[model samples]
Target: MSTKMIFINLPVEDLNRSKAFYEAVGWKVNADFTDENAACIVVDDNICLMLLTKTFFTTFSQRPIADTVAATAAAYALALASADEVDVLTDAAVAAGATEEHCPDKRAQEAEVGMHGRTFIDPDGHQWEPFYMAYQAA
Candidate 1:
């Protein structure tokens, strides 16, 4: 089967601010698909995001956009290859204005599941989890 690319679409109140936040956290914006109303954040070769202004985003759906500040519509999670990378990404997100989702004691849940990660809420209140999971060879 052919590989399918993933494009996550998020509606934002402020296009520039949201774009800046993503850029500050190290994701490159693809100008090829970006304009004043939207930006394409490249997470990788196969995964990316289309950050659109609420007004522009609404054109795709009849329903009103979810108020991310008040309710979480979904959580975006990225899988890292190493535990240290998880920490680095999380720290970068925090420095870039993302809020931690869980408390310190509960943030690292590696011991129980062989997975370590951190969750953060972005400026627009979108939840993101950067995690690492060790693959056990059978």
Candidate 2:
């Protein structure tokens, strides 16, 4: 059998605050399973962000939780249909109080050729990148 990613669990200090941050950036919660300590932020039809309060998250693992606020060990990147979509999403993130880490810019040297991308940091400093590729005909 093949593996597929259905959910990503992120530990947060405040569940409500994390939910609000995601909501501001156009994500909705899965009400069927979300609660005061855990919220499922739907990213797409197959992707979801499981936001769990620190205390609740500890129940699942024994490893020390990474301090997201002060560390940059990982990031989430999303692809859009067009370069304009990247700008639009980045703008929405800014309006939602997310810090813009990198503005959208073209990278002709990469495999995407004329692609553009931007990065933003969520409230807890989780990095997210939105990108669009303009591929040349082979």
Estimate the lDDT of model 1: 0.87
TM-score result, candidate 1: 0.90
lDDT by residue (42-107, candidate 2, tens digit) is 987778999999999998899988887788758888888987888988888888878888443333
Q: Clashing residue pairs in candidate 1, if any? A: none
- Give the range where candidate 1 is weakest over 10 consecutive residues by summed lDDT: 103-112
Model 2 TM-score, all chains together: 0.84
Off by over 4 Å in 2: 1-5, 103-112
lDDT of each: 0.87, 0.81
TM-score of each: 0.90, 0.84
**Model 1, which residues run further than 4 Å from truth?**
103-110
Query: How do the residues 88-121 of candidate 1 rate in per-residue lDDT, one tens digit apiece?
Result: 8888889988898875665444546677878889
Give the Å shift of residue 127 in candidate 2. Answer: 0.7
Sum up the clashes in candidate 1: 0
